[model samples]
Target: MVMQTINKIISANEKINDVLMNQSGLLDVVVYENASYDLNLLQAGQSLKVKVSLLGQNACCTLRTVYLSGTDADNKIEFEVIHAVEQTNSKQEIKGVAAGFGKADFYGVIRMPHGSQKCEGSQSHKALLLSDNACIKCTPELEIYADDVKCAHGSSIGTLDETYLFYLMSRGIDETTARQMLIKAFLLSDMPQAFETEIDKWMEANE
Candidate 1:
């Protein structure tokens, strides 16, 4: 018999991503075996270090994070994913934005030591800078030592599309509102539908 992974939807527009929305406080780093996980790190609170381990035949997880730093703020994020068992898989997707005079550092790693066979892992990190002094550092690393496994990591940083801003403004949107709309879309576009409203509310309040 072939083993199967069950994914139960929490709501009409929610899936595994909503399972851990409430627990994604950027500090609740814990190992949850044999389950699909989604971690949404909204912003930097002090400095954060995240780590995850995948072991056993049924281990699977997906982690997602986001960060937006205000002016004159400094933030650092470090995370690692280790695959140590066979038939396990994991993925990490990260996004961030830094305002003027702010600095954000994103460092991530994926490791598959010897004997960890038939394991698959993937990671991606992307960030956007909002001003001249906005700074973001993305570093993705991988260490593979086992056979019959697949692992990859990537990082990218960019700025807002001025053409897109112009297009939005041409449609009669004020500059400030247009800017806010673009920022919101960049930060929350891929988030689960179940969380878009609540997170948008929180974002506005925090802004």
Candidate 2:
């Protein structure tokens, strides 16, 4: 496959395999020197699976995914990124919120094969629960076969921070607005500006 520069946004409503996979079930992304492929995905009340492969030296990918669950909704998402050559790099950031009896689960993996030396990969999954009945879980895995690689993975499931809320409330903001602001701050880094309206609606409806 010839190297092509690509930066695209993936829609949550479409099936992952239909949109991203080839006949062999892999999105064989061939990136090369000075090239990159970037994808941003948002999922609400749906399940999605994605596998991306970086095929050459100096290839790079950056993926940002968000999972939002509504009332009584169950959602799961899995992501895998494979670095097949030396000097490749990738970073994945995942964020989520579950409210009103909603449940969310995420699994992510970054793999670097034996000869893929000097490759760098990092991923983090973080989720928050808004209701007492809400549930959230995250599992992150890093498989590195090369000794000269830098790879890290982290996962966390938690609720909103009260101290940040308190700080906002002290400035005369109401409890509800303060809480929402704090939650928005947590997600601002990874979310795209294009989804602002949709995310605001989700927050309003979940509240």
Candidate 3:
């Protein structure tokens, strides 16, 4: 049994070394960008890949909402992932929130190399839209060359749950306050503890 934690800080437009997290090994990756990057992970047995990408534009404040809320239609962020191996099990779940005119595009590809057996993998990408012009696209692809693997992929783009909003309203929160709370929750869902505090502060100043 192997147990370890992998943490790395990468500059923009850099290529990260291939990370292999074996059984019982934990991998955590956080990426913030104005540039591009390539990250690869391999799983011979059971593996976990935890990744977070913060794509922002310093030249424009309008893009901030798109980076966090996933609602700005003019903001464009693209993400891609590829998996290649056999008997390799993996789970990848990505969540994003967009506000204002921000936009996001997610692309995921899972491939089972030839001769791989009993491989199982699942991928899911979800985003929340906070404005009328907010835009998002999710595309998950699977290419299996082996016959004995079980794999699945899913993508969803939508706004906050109205039922949750209604419940908040019933509990005495005003509509705008409820919206703000929900939006915060959505944007912070996958952020790390260290960054969450700073992100909240930034949100306060920007919003």
Write one digit per residue (lDDT tens) for candidate 3, span 1-207: 355666655455554444231222444444334333333321112323333332222100001111343222222223222223333344565556555665555555665667656656667666777778766676677877789978887777887899999999999999877877876676556433333554455345434
Error of 3 at 125 (Å): 1.0
Model 2 lDDT per residue over 50-160, tens place: 676777677777777777787865677777888888988898888889989998888889999989899999998888888899988788888888999999988888888
Deviation from native of the Cα of residue 85 in model 2, angstroms: 1.2
Better of 2 and 3 by lDDT: 2
Q: List the residue pairs that clash in candidate 2.
A: none
- Residue 83 Cα positional deviation in candidate 3, in Å, after optimal superposition: 4.7
Clash number for candidate 3: 15
> Can you write out model 1's per-residue Cα lDDT over 1-207, one digit (the tens) per residue?
232222332222222443333222133223334655466655543366666666455566677877666565566777777776777788888877777677888888888899888889998888888778878888888888897898888888898888999999999998767877887787776754444664455446434
Model 3 TM: 0.58
